[model samples]
Target: MNKITTNAFHPMQLKISQADIGYKEILISGADAQLQSGEVCLLIGNNGVGKTTLIRSVLHQIAILRGTITLGDKNIQELSVKEIAEYIAVVLSKSAIPQNYTVNDLVSLGKYIHYPFYFELSKEDQKEVRETIENLGLQQYDATPLKNLSDGNLQKAFIGRALTQNSPVIILDEPTTHLDEKNKIIILKTLRKLAREHHKLILFSSHDWRLAKEFADKIWYIKDRTLHAGMVEDVLIRHHELTDPSLFNVNEYFKAPHIIAPPLYKEMLYSLLQKNSTADLSHLSFEFMDNRWHIDAKGNGYQCGSFEEILVLVKTLH
Candidate 1:
C-alpha cells in the first residue's frame, strides 16, 4: 500500500479526462475537469443533465464508459473502497437513516471506517463527533430521533457526519436541498470555510444559483455534453449557454412591473420576466456599490415581495 500524505496544505487534486458519463447512454461526453485543494466548485445544471451520473463516476459507484479519473497521486480506479474512503467523504442526496437513530448515533457511525464492527467509539472519535455536531448547529438535536427532526435539520446532521469523517475531499449532492434561505447560506458558507481554512476539496451540486454563485469560488456548469469550469465570474461571463435566459414577452402579456434593482440580479430579473410573462427585462438597468442592490432610475421604485405585488406595482408605475 502506498503511504498517503496527511498534510492538509499539500497540493491535492481530482482530475477527470474525456469520459462518457451516464446510465446506459451518455448524457455528457468528452468531459474534462479538475479541482485542486482549497477550492470550492459548484456543479450547476437542469434536471436529467447527468450531474449525478458524473458524481457517481467520480465516486467509483458507476463505471466510466471511457475516461480516466485521478485523485491526487493515484488513479481512482486503482483504489479500493476503503482506500478511497480515506481520501473523500460524500453526503448523499437521498440516504435513508434509521428512524430510531439519534443525531449522535448517525455522526458516530462515520468512524466505522477506522473501527468497523466496533460498537464503542474511541474518546478522540467521540470528541470529533461532538465538535462536528456543534459546528453544524446540531447540538440542540443531539438526542433527537431522526424521524422527529425537520428535513433541514436532518440534512445538517448528515453534513455533520460527513465532516466528522475527516476526508480531504468532500462531495455533497444538493446539501441544501430541504434547507430554507438561512440554513442554505449556513451550509454553503461552511463548505467555503472548509475548503479555504481546512484545505479541503469541496464540490457540490446546487439548484440555488444565487447562493451557489455568491459563495462558490468557481462553477462547473454541465450543459450540451460539456462541463464548463472556471472562476464564477469568468464562467458566467464567458459561457453564453449557461446564461441563456428564458425569453419572456412580458410587455405583450401581463402587467409588467418596473424594477430598479442591482445588476447582480441578472438571473432573478430574467426569471421574474418569464414568470410575469408581460414585462421586458432586456432594457432593465441597475447599480450596486457592493453586493447590495441599488437602482439608479428616474422614478420612485416600489419594492415588491412577490409576482402578484409586482402586478400592482406596475399599475402604479403607469
Candidate 2:
C-alpha cells in the first residue's frame, strides 16, 4: 500500500508520475499532484511544460512510462476509459464540433456516456442538457449551429457539454486561449462557482497569472524541469529560486506612482509582509531596489527597506 502523506488532502483527483508521452525519457519526472474536493487548481508554466501531456497521462488516453495515478482511492490504470469518464470530464484546448451540429446537439452528446448502445435520451438527460445550456447563458444559441457561433459562444457551448457529463472533476487545458477579456472572466468565474457551490474539482491550465492567483485555491508551477505544488501564494513566492536571470528580463514598471513588480517578485514581497504582520500593506506604495532587484515599500516619499521598518513608521503615524 502506498503510504499517503500527511499533507495529502482528501483527493478529489490525483496524478502521479504517469507519463504516456512519446518522449523516450520522461518530460516530467516524478511528478505528483493531488486536488481536494471543491478546490480549484491552476496549472501554470511556460509553453511546452507538459500540462497537456500530464492530463492525458492521468486520463490514460496515453500510456505512462512509469508510476500510478489514483482518483478517490481507485487506481486510474485499473479503470477503463468509460469508467474514468464517469468521474472525470475534460474540456480540451480545441473541441471539434461537426459542421451541422447545433449547440444543443453538442451539449446533448455528453449524455452518451450514460446511454446504452441504442443511446436513447431519457427525460432526465434532456433536463440536464437544458439546464447546462441555461446555466452557461447559452439559451439564445441553443439552436444555432456550432460552426456559425462566435469563439466565445462556442467555448461556452463546450463548457456546457462538460457540465452535462456531471462528473466530479473537470480538467481544462488553456481554456481562455482565444477568449476576450470579458469572456475569459466569465468562464473563470463560472468554473470557480462550480467548484465552490457544486463541490466539484476544477483544474485548468492558463498563462493568466493574475486571474489564476485571484481564483485558484492551489497552483502547480513547473520550472527548470521540476514541478512545485502549494497554495498560489506559496508557489509564487518560491518561484524566485527557479528564476533564470539570463533568459528573462526582470524590471519594475510603475502602474500608477507605485512600482509594480513582476508576478513572482510581487508575490515574494507579499510573503515578506505576511511574515512580519506589522505593516498594513493596504496603504503603502511599492518601489523597486535598483541595485538588488528587491521590491520595497514607500510612503510619503520615505522608503522602508522591510516590513518591520514599515511597521515602525506606521507606529509613528498620528
Candidate 3:
C-alpha cells in the first residue's frame, strides 16, 4: 500500500481495470471517471452485466481477482471498510429494515457512520435527519412504521438514510425498480438536486436508459465482457460494438422518443405504430414521437405511420 496526502476538498473517483468476481468478469478495463466534487452519473446495462459487481469492487465489499481501484490517488484495497464508509454512502437494491422501526428511526440510522459509538443522536444530528426526511417529502411518514409504508415511501426512506450519512460520494443500485412513474421521477429529481445543489457525487444503476440519459452527466455501459464509459450519447450509439445485437436486443432502445412513458400507453402506442405504413421510417424524431403526429407537405399534420413504420423508423435512426 502507498500513502498519499489526502485533500477533503478534492473530488472522488474510481479507476479500475481487469477486475473480476465469482462467475462475472470485467477485463482489460480502464475508466477515468471523475465524479466531480458534485455531479450525477448513471450506471446502465442489461441484467447480469456486472454493473453491481463493479460497484461492489469499488467499495471493497468483494475481492477483486485482479486490477486496482483508486479513490482519488489512494487504492481502495489499502483503505479499511470504515474509511470507505466515511466517504461513500450506499442504498442497496433491497432493504430489510425492522418492520417495527419508524421512518425517523430508520433515517436516523444514517448518522451511525458519523457517530458510530453514540447511543443517542445529538441535537444537530437529529436536526439533520429531520431536515433530510422533510426534503425527501417523508415528513408524513416520519412516524409510520417501515412495513406499513408503500414501496415508494420505503424507497424514499432509504434515500433519506443515505442523505443522513452526508458522504461525499453516494451510490444506489436500481433505486427506481418497483416504483411507479411518478415515484421514479421524484427519486431521479431528488438525486439531481443532491448532485447539483449539495455538490455530492451521485452514482446509481438503472435499466431505464431514457431516464439515465436525461438525468446523468455520464454513463457507464457494461456488456458482454467490456465496460464503456462516456457521455450517454456516445456510449448508447456505440453499443453495437460491445455485444451482438441479436443477443442483447439493443435495437429496441433505439426507438424514437425513447422517453419513459406510462407502461400501458407506451406498449399500446408502440404496437399500433408498428402496424401502419407510409410513416416516415428514417430517423427517430423525438419531437415527432411526443407530439403523436408529423407535418406533411400541406402543413397540416396527421398521426404518423402504423406501429410497424414507427418501429422501422426507430431502428433506422439507430
For each candidate, what is the lDDT? 0.77, 0.72, 0.71
Expressed as tens digits, the lDDT of each residue in 1-318 for candidate 3 is 343333565556566655554334443254434456567888887787678877887789886776677776788888887888887899988878876899998899988987745578989999999998998788988999998998888988998899899887889999998788887887889889888888788889987777766788878777655667777678767774332222332244323233234444455544444444334433332224564634233242334445555555444433
lDDT of 2 by residue, 104-191 (tens): 9999987887777487798988998998898777899989999899888888888888888878889988888878888788788889
Worst 10 residues of 1 by lDDT: 280-289
Off by over 4 Å in 3: 1-9, 18-34, 240-270, 273-318
Considering TM-score, which of the candidate structures 2 and 3 is the better prediction for this target? 3
When summed lDDT is taken over every stretch of 10 residues in candidate 2, the lowest stretch is 249-258
Cα lDDT of candidate 1 equals 0.77
Instruction: Report the C-alpha lDDT of model 1 over 1-318, residue by residue, as the tens digit.
Output: 654554655588888888778878888888888989999999988888888888888999988888888888787888888888878899988989877999999988778766666568879889989988887888999999999999999999888878888788999998999998888888888888998899899999986555556788878888887888788988888765454443223345543334444443654754655564554433333433354434322554434445456445443543
For each candidate in turn, the TM-score is: 0.81, 0.72, 0.74
Please report how far candidate 3 places residue 128 from its true position, in Å. Answer: 1.5
Candidate 2 segments exceeding 4 Å error: 1-11, 15-22, 117-120, 240-318
Error of 3 at 233 (Å): 2.9
Cα deviation at 138, candidate 2, in Å, is: 1.7
